[model samples]
Target: MLKTTLGQWRMFRAVVEHGGFSQAGDAIHKSQSTIHHAVQKLEDSLGIKLLQVKGRKVGLTQAGELMLRRANYLLDEAAKLEAVATGLGAGTETQLKIAVDEVFPQNLLYRVLDTVSAQFPLLRIELMETVLSGAQELLEKARVDIALSPVPLANGFNEEFCQIEFLAVASPQHALHQQTQALSYEDLKSHRQIVVRDSASNSGKDVGWLGADQRWTVSHVRTSIDMISQGFGYAWLPVPAIEQELQSGLLKPLPLTQGVKRTAQLYLCFADGDRLGPAARTFIGEVRYQSESLLTAEQLSDSN
Candidate 1:
């Protein structure tokens, strides 16, 4: 059995992420020479060349890739152990850290959290609202216990969550209301629009029949809704976020020929699958229950 140091494992993981010692050094805030020396030491100790230096670029060898995966698993287990130990001394309830997409309606999440608080008031819940990609990264890094993000994982994260529907909406006083009974994509494109800029890509998709103009690129869903409410531009918001606004006639659903519908799946990704603590498991269960209940209510209303 080869003895591996945590520092070597961290260096290996960093190199795999940044693709080079220089970049990895920048990320880890270390000198490039130091990072290279550490990696060299690791390779020497393991008796294998982990990375192949191809010109200026660095590529992982088969052994390197395998080692990286194992390294991540080992690190995750170590973190869970620390968390468990800390939790034992603190109390029976553990802290649950969750990362959520900025587009998720706070009201809905609060409803879910309220239920969890009532059930387990002693548990500490930490919520972070960030971009979808950032949230996914947090989950992979074990920076968060779980994440609430769009259905499809933008990165290589495995989807272990539920899905919700997205709706395109506008303020009731907007010009689209004139044709509310028969809204088309063309009508929406002709009006000033506020859209969630695809942070992952510069190109915008023609949602349904509505063409996105590059002039108004709102980064956050909450900002998009605020802009639409102020009549700055119309936007496609998640139904749950703007459900109350639509019901109260503050915002109106666009009448599209194809009915612009997109499903936003909420995934609860974790770094270590087997190491979920009691608080993390309880929080996940609450979210799942809330999502199922909400879906059921929506279906019942639609049926009625």
Candidate 2:
């Protein structure tokens, strides 16, 4: 049996965080005497002095500082335990909100979703297709439970999800193809460029080359692809998205001196990791597993 109770540790933490017993009492809606008793009881249970009085405010002793760290870990674990219990009691979630950047492979996304839907037939998914920083923005606002984005959430948990291959390409009829030798940035600068607009309202910025004299910004990836294929303009497009066009000779890769291909690394982020229910956890695991499988297959093909 543990000598200290969770209540005691919680009160001790509140007192330390708020800087005094009265402040902690006010924060927690408890009387100062009640907070003081809990802290005193905690010190007694631990058989050590946790706080020392200095002037009007209380300060932690050397032992208190060390124990506080351990106490915080314990408290965090306890909270996670309660969250898990709550999730279990609530059963599987009826709906899940996911924000996926358009750059991620559609086939892989479909495969993961198909598997998840099979497992939870009754669950609804709100899939928000975003671009660049859009996914991260939705996660920051707590509008999505999970986000797959190249841009990671600031000071938040993230894992390398997948890599998207971007190839700079243009139509065979485009003016850039008229060059006899390898193309340079200077050669392409005179032509028009088609770019997809960033979906985020704020904190959105352009990526890759932007030196073309005339620029056309579109809202969707398909729009950019359509414009580029019809000889409207040239742009760096994702290989997975334009595979059919590339294979059929509708779009040709640019013979650039350098940077003909670029890889964008996408990350998996959660709005509140600890609060994720069973369905969300399972989906996260499946996505990771599928991405790993794809990466391994690609690596083997590259080696051969």
Candidate 3:
């Protein structure tokens, strides 16, 4: 049998967090005496001194510090329990917000979305196409329910979703392809390089950008592909995104001694995994299914 109540632990934590009984009471809309009584009863039940006081100042004892840690974890679990109950009671969500990095394969994304839509016809979905850290920012800010990003956000959970292959290429007729020898950094830097701008507002980043004498920054991968195919500049573009250009000889691979091909692993991250409703869970499952199916199909094609 449990001798202590969660209510007592809640009050105990509130006192420590707010720095005093009166402050805790004010914060929790309880009287100071009530808060003090709860904490006192909690300590009595636990048979330990949880707090110390000196001249109107309150601080936790050594044992109180450990108890406070456990109290925090307990309270967090309780909150998550409530959130799970609430989500289950709410049934399917009315809307789903998702942020997807531009690098993720469009075919796979579209297929998954089509499947999810068929399952939940009335569920509204707001899909934001982002570049680089844009998806991470949206997920971190709780603006999106889920995000696909190359790098996982700090203090969040993520699962490996897929790997995107980026190939450095230029137009077949471009001057760089005229060289017989493998291209060096100096050789590539002399020509114009096209780069996709990171879509994050405040903390955008640049990747796969060589310090070329001339550079063009665009907002989307398609824009970069279009510019590069027109012989305006050279850039590393995702293989799935530039398949037609590759097959048609519009874009030829740059023969770099190193980094000719780069692979980035994308992760599927949830803003709040525990609070995801039925719709979000369904979407996540479909994403996994579609990604695996695509990979398997591609492998079979390669094998043949």
Candidate 4:
């Protein structure tokens, strides 16, 4: 028996990722037969089957799953080795990618970004503005180094960043507002509700009240806010994103008997929280600082 080569592992991982040999070949820019031969040679060297074909698609065998995990770790190590080598010479990353959920305060993030850019003038920044589970998905794919996600990050060091308050509101001119009586859950059920679609890759859910016979789904929270402000429907919107509307008397909180507002706790998460580059560390610190400031402001307001 011969030792398995890194090349085989690379091809195997590609096949599993792309879901088929032909797809993997297309991704790796190799002939399908060449890709198939490489994986076959790999199985022969290891004396085990790594994949099973199901119709036109391919699935990893139990052994393949374990091997794939190890391969990814090795690949990550290889990448880090290059990063370390480059850092010793360059002293900075060429680009820093960060993923953030819309649930998190955008203004605070902008402030943090401003600080990061001010300090690292030459370092390029990639901002991935995602919603719902999009941040988590980006993190899992190794697409971004840091993430501020609404959902719990499954594979990183995560800490509570801040809680955002959401107010259930509708246009002031909405029929629900015209009612002389307080709006109840039953009344809401009859009116249309604007709901933001969860951006999760799998098992994306519909959050909050859906009792309304009529529902409109939007990809982003701001879109939902726009729909609600237009008197098209009612929704639970983050208070910060609707502050102007609230102040201008365009959007008013639902006069619900209960559950007029809800708080969503967002987390600041990082895949390598401890080994973050200087740019990432600075950004995270600034983000945390701003988050604390927001919390303090909220507390003071509540006290008054």
Q: Could you report the Cα RMSD, in angstroms, for every candidate shown?
A: 5.0, 6.8, 5.3, 3.1
TM-score: model 4 vs. ground truth? 0.85
State, as a TM-score between 0 and 1, how close model 2 is to the true structure. Answer: 0.72
Q: What is the C-alpha lDDT profile of model 2 across 1-304, one tens digit per residue?
A: 9998989899999999998999999999999999999999888988999999889889999999999999988987787688668877888888888999998889999998989999999989899999999999998876888999999999578998788999999999998998899999898899999999889989559999999999999889999999999999999999989999999999999999998999999999985677787778888998999999989999999999
Models 1 onward score TM values of: 0.70, 0.72, 0.73, 0.85
| lDDT tens digits, residue span 1-304, model 3 | 9989899999999998888999999999999999899999988888999999956878999999999999987987788798778778888788889999999999888988888889999999999999999999998777898999986988678899799999999999899999999997788888999999989989658887567999989999999999999999999899999998999999999999888899999999985687898788889999999899888988999999
Q: lDDT per model, in order?
A: 0.72, 0.91, 0.90, 0.86
Candidate 4 displacement at residue 299 in angstroms? 1.2
- Residue 275, model 2, lDDT: 76
Residue 194 of model 1, lDDT score: 76
Question: Alpha carbon lDDT of residue 99, candidate 1?
Answer: 84
| Backbone clashes (count) for model 4 | 0
The sequence of per-residue lDDT tens digits that candidate 4 reaches over residues 83-168 is 66676577666678998888777788889999999999998999988887788888877788888888877867889978889899
Worst 10 residues of 1 by lDDT: 200-209
